[model samples]
Target: MKTVGLALAVTLLATVHVVAGDTRFERSLRNLDPSARLEQICDYTAMLRIRASTPFRPDRAVGSASSPAKAASNMLVANGAAFRSRKKWYRLSYTCKTTPDRMKVLAFDYKTGPEIPEEKWNTYGLWR
Candidate 1:
């Protein structure tokens, strides 16, 4: 019975992995020119927020984003799922730049909502 249970668990895990294939957002992030480096910068929760949100096209961004000079060159953008926590709607924006060396995060901006305003994110953005 123990062996059977273990096998079933493994099979379920594998099935989950296969079912959750790379999403478009996942693919874009993975295929970054210089490859993004996010481990040291972001914690598990932050990463989770970004991963939970995907296919961050401009239209779905909810707010306007203006790239800052500080955001390295060749920037790529993606947004995470929008969620409501404690009566507040929140969203995550992952912006990174691919330099000749490696992709580095320019900003991970968390925008607050009820009514998200359209503004230059790099200039007036909040970071987590």
Candidate 2:
């Protein structure tokens, strides 16, 4: 019974994680350049993880803000990223690591910064 319970728990955990990629996210990668694909995967992770972990609902995320992110070899360290939530842009930075094919996000670590001032949005290429 203990073995069965453990197996069941593992199965449920797997199901929840796998369900995140059951959509067209993986399929869409076939059409993008390698670098673009990596960005897409990491951006998707940003939106999904933030929504799941925070009260904010992020619809978009840009990896570049005040400065361009450092992306290389399946890893992206975005120190000046931004995420749009509830029509407001917030400062965001994240380190996202992905698989070789850039189809799966292996890990994502992120921090949300203070709200970007409305007057300064133009400087960062942020929208209203």
Candidate 3:
């Protein structure tokens, strides 16, 4: 009985950790209004762009599909890419699967404010 209880406890803990790790992205989106627009800015091919905007806010972030996990917290701005907005800025991470023309932006996250930098971004797949 003791072993069974311990095993069950461990299983529950692991499940919670996985669920928690996945929630950041969902939480970020939850703050947006239903009308917010999520756009596919660029096609795949190691480079891709996605934009999400809300009338209440005008900030956004764009990153490659292979962009690292730390991208979530750091707010990294890709080289040669311009981040535009007068309001707060957001972070967007993506995963490309094919050529630039055939590729597609997979996932991303958004928040208000400038990027934190490569080091500060969370390594978790919050935007994956």
Candidate 4:
């Protein structure tokens, strides 16, 4: 009976931790900058990790059809999802970039396969 009680307590603790983490993620999304510029948007550098849910595909057609700059601009306007590591929970940041030519939004994963070195992510729009 004692062992069972102990196990139950551990399970409850784990569940609480998971719920708290999720809450933090939601809060982060709410805190994202709604008016950040494309250049200043992806300028995040830290031991942080981000998780994006939306599909991310390079706008090759746009790049070929227009100029490289224009294609990059279109990519940033697409909608997507993103997750970042924070003190207590992962912060979620969503981006939606709209310009006269195009609009896009997306979620991004900063802590993907390999650690992306701290560098300037110069582009013309927002990323999730």
Q: Pick the candidate with the highest TM-score.
A: 2
Model 4 TM-score on a 0 to 1 scale: 0.30
* lDDT (Cα atoms) of all candidates against the true structure: 0.39, 0.88, 0.36, 0.32
Worst 10 residues of 1 by lDDT: 56-65
* lDDT string, candidate 3, 1-128, tens digits: 99999999999999999689547644654464422212222211112122324433323334432243222221223332223334323443333222222222344333333443444333422231
Question: Candidate 1 residues 4-67, lDDT tens each?
Answer: 9999999999988855743434454556433233322222224444446743222223222232
Candidate 2 lDDT over residue span 26-105, tens digit each:
77887899898888888778988899999999998988876888889999999999999998999999999999988888
Q: How do the candidates rank by lDDT, highest first?
A: 2, 1, 3, 4
TM-score, every prediction? 0.27, 0.79, 0.26, 0.30
- Identify the runs in model 3 with alpha carbons over 4 angstroms from their true place: 30-128
- Measured by lDDT, the strongest candidate is 2
Q: Output the TM-score of candidate 2.
A: 0.79
RMSD (CA, Å), candidate 2 to true, equals 5.2
Q: How does candidate 4 score on lDDT? A: 0.32
- Mark the 10 consecutive residues where model 2 has the least summed lDDT: 18-27
